[model samples]
Target chain A: MKENNSFILGIKHGIPICLGYLSVSFAFGIFAVGSGLSVIEALLISMFNLTSAGQLAAVPIITGGGGIPELALAQLIINLRYSLMSVTLSQKLGKTVSALDRFWIGFGITDEIFAVSTSKNKSVGRKYMFGLILTPYAGWSLGTLLGSVAGNILPDSVSSALGIAIYGMFIAIVLPTVKKHLPTALCVVGAIAIGCAFKYIPMLSRVPDGFVIIIAAVVASMVAALLSPVSDEESEQTDEKEVNTDA
Target chain B: MPSMNFFFHLGVMAGITYLVRMLPLVLVNKKIRNRFLLSFLYYVPYAVLSVMTVPAIFYATSSPWSALAGFVIAMILAFFEKSLLTVAIFSSAAVFVTEFLLPIIQ
Candidate 1:
């Protein structure tokens, strides 16, 4: 009965995440197809890899004929922050989550899932984790499937507008926090400045898109860390705010 | 577009992403004590997402102006703490409207 209850609660919590992912992944579906990937390939990509930013970054590299090393490095850099979330979430696991269950649970630890699970007052268990992950996974894959299919049929004017949907989502994720938090606002500003330099400067503009993201992210994050180190207590508050960022 | 090569590349990307998530939860039993590292990780999503959004967003639509309109709408909605879907949809709508009107205005 207890197991069933947590599972239900997990599903309830996950519904919102699932709904949010539907739109974002729908945009991803359209973007991937617009970028020349077959609809099935886009669907397969979403099903196999649930990382939104990671997959978004990967599509360009894949379509551009980037090599294995470049694609690997791009995924690693773009998705590396999940490691931190996974590490943090590991501490919240209950005894019901055995060592083996860690691997399964880890697969579902996107930014939103990690936030949802960790925000719970009780320790997360295997059943609860499974229940929580299932809905969002379905929503993500389904959204992509729908969007990719629609991409082929949607008019160019509409599809072109849809291209900004993902970026709009990103801005939505980053800007709200910027209003409330100083370090985050500064970090975003600094990163955008660096990003602009890479996009416009004659010499630096030659750097590939993959490397530019790496440099901008690493340098800005390192600077923020050095300038405004967040203490453990402070980190907890940030985690609460993270519920809105990734989905 | 080669079937075998596409599958191979897809596997590599998915494999690397899975390993990044899995390795940490499986290996790290204790909380990381490094404050600097933790801070860096905390700020990483912001940095990376911001870098990806800007300049690129400006080019996401048919015209930079339309993209900017979408971006501005997104930022305003986000500033007011609108839901993610609301912001995203409205931003796209803003772009659509801007693109439709740009020709007449020009």
Candidate 2:
């Protein structure tokens, strides 16, 4: 009964995430189809690969007929951030959630879900995380289906405008914390500057998007972490079940 | 078209992504004691999102002006603490309207 309630709550919280994802994934679906992948292939990619940025980065390589080594390397750099996220989230899981559960959650954790689960005032459990993950998961897959079908029939101007919707979602994610935290705001600015340099600088302009994101994220975050280490209170493990889970 | 190449590329992407995510969860069962590293992890999402949004957002629409308008609308809506759905929808609408009106004005 309790699991059901938490799952419902997760779905509730996920509603907005689902809505945001629908638009973004719709954009991606269009991009994928444009790149020559069939709707089923695009849909499968979105369903199997939930990480938005990583999948977007993969499109060009997949379309280019790049070798597996290049594809894997790109995936590694672009998706590496999730490894860090899962590590942080692992500390928050309680004993009730098993190692197998953690593995499942880890695979499902995206930026939005991680942000929502961690911000809870109380320790998050498997039920809530599961609840939280389910909606966005559906939203992404459904959005891909919608985007793929819709993209082909849409007028060029409308499709072109819809292209930026995913970026808008990214903006929404950062804006909330950016308002409250100086370091977070600066980190964003620094990352953007780094990204721009890669795009504009003659020598570095040829760098791939995945490499650029990896570099910006690593360099900017390392500097922020050093300069603005969070207060001890914030770092205290709040998950009530964290201790028992480790055993 | 050899089906092997297509499946091979997708498989590699999926496998690598899944491994990176699952490995950390399975391997790091203990709480991290290091504050700096924790803070660094905390900022990764923000940095990643920021880098991906800028420059890229500028190119998302047919016209730079339309994309810029939509991006500005998104920032303003986000600044007011609008829900993600609201921000995205309104911003996309902003782009749509701008794209529609641009040729008329020209």
Candidate 3:
């Protein structure tokens, strides 16, 4: 009975997240179809990989006929943050979670979900975690289905306009943090500078999109990390502030 | 057609993504003590998102001008710390309106 209550609470907490994902995933679905994927193909990608940025990066590689190593490496670079979130989350798991349960719960560790779960005052249990994941998963998959169908039917002009929606979402994700954090601001500027060089310079323009993204991200992040390594005390304070703001 | 079958690519993407999330949760019972690694991980998302957004964003729409309009709107709203959904929808609207007006203006 107690487990059931937490599960219900989790679903209730997930409603706003579901609504937010619907629009973002819809844009993704249209973008994927515009990039040459069939509607079903777009839907499949969203269903299998419940990541916005990772899926955004993956679609280009997939359609461009990128190799397995390229795909794997891109996924690693794009989703590496999840590994860190999972580590932090593991410490917050309630005693009800068993070894096998950890594997299943691991699948739902998106940035939003992690924030919601961690923001709670108490440790989260397996049932609550599953409940939290279920609603957003459905929202994400359903939104893709709607958007993919819309992409096929919508006129070219409108669909083309929708193409910028994802990038707008990307900007929304990065800019607020950049505004507050100097290292992060420099990281964005550095990455953008590298990105432009690869796009414009004749010799560097020869590099594939996958490798260019990887190189810019890795190099910029490495430089930022080296320049101002965050100590444990500062990291914890930031985490608390993030959770507080999230709540 | 892709060099390999589509399922193969899907498998690789899904497999690698899942493994990265799963390994840490299942194996790591303690807080990560490595500072540089943590900082690098902290900065990765911002760097990756920035690299992907610029240059590419300017080309996302039919007109680079419209894309720029949307990008500017998104950056402004985001600087004020608007919600993700709000920023995304308004930016798309900005693009739609800008694209509509461009042909007439020219």
Candidate that scores best on TM-score: 1
Give the number of the best model, judged by DockQ.
Answer: 1
The ten-residue window of minimal lDDT in model 3 chain A covers A238-247
- Tens digits of per-residue lDDT, candidate 2, A1-247, equal 1222266787787876777677778878987876678888888788888988788878877887655666787678667767776777777676667878877887788766766666555566778778788998999999999998887889987777677777776776678668877888999999999999999999998776667777888899999999998764543332221111111
Model 1 stretches with alpha carbons more than 4 Å out:
A1-5, A244-247
The per-residue C-alpha lDDT of model 1 at residue B39 equals: 90
In terms of TM-score, which candidate is stronger, 2 or 3?
3
Error of 3 at B23 (Å): 1.0
Interface RMSD after interface superposition, each candidate: 1.5, 4.1, 1.7
Q: For model 3, what share of native contacts is present? A: 0.83
Per-residue C-alpha lDDT of model 1 across residues A1-247, encoded as one tens digit per residue:
1222378878888898898899989999999999989988999899889989989888888898878888888889889988988888888888788889998887888888888888766788787888899999999999999999988999999998899998988888788778887998999999889989988999998777777788889899999999999888776776667575544
Q: Report the TM-score for the A-chain of model 3.
A: 0.92
What's the TM-score of chain A alone for every prediction?
0.93, 0.75, 0.92
Q: How close is candidate 3 to the true structure, as a TM-score?
A: 0.94
Best by lDDT: 1
Docking class of 3: medium
DockQ value for model 3: 0.73
Please give the fraction of native interface contacts (Cα pairs under 8 Å between A and B) kept by each candidate: 0.82, 0.74, 0.83
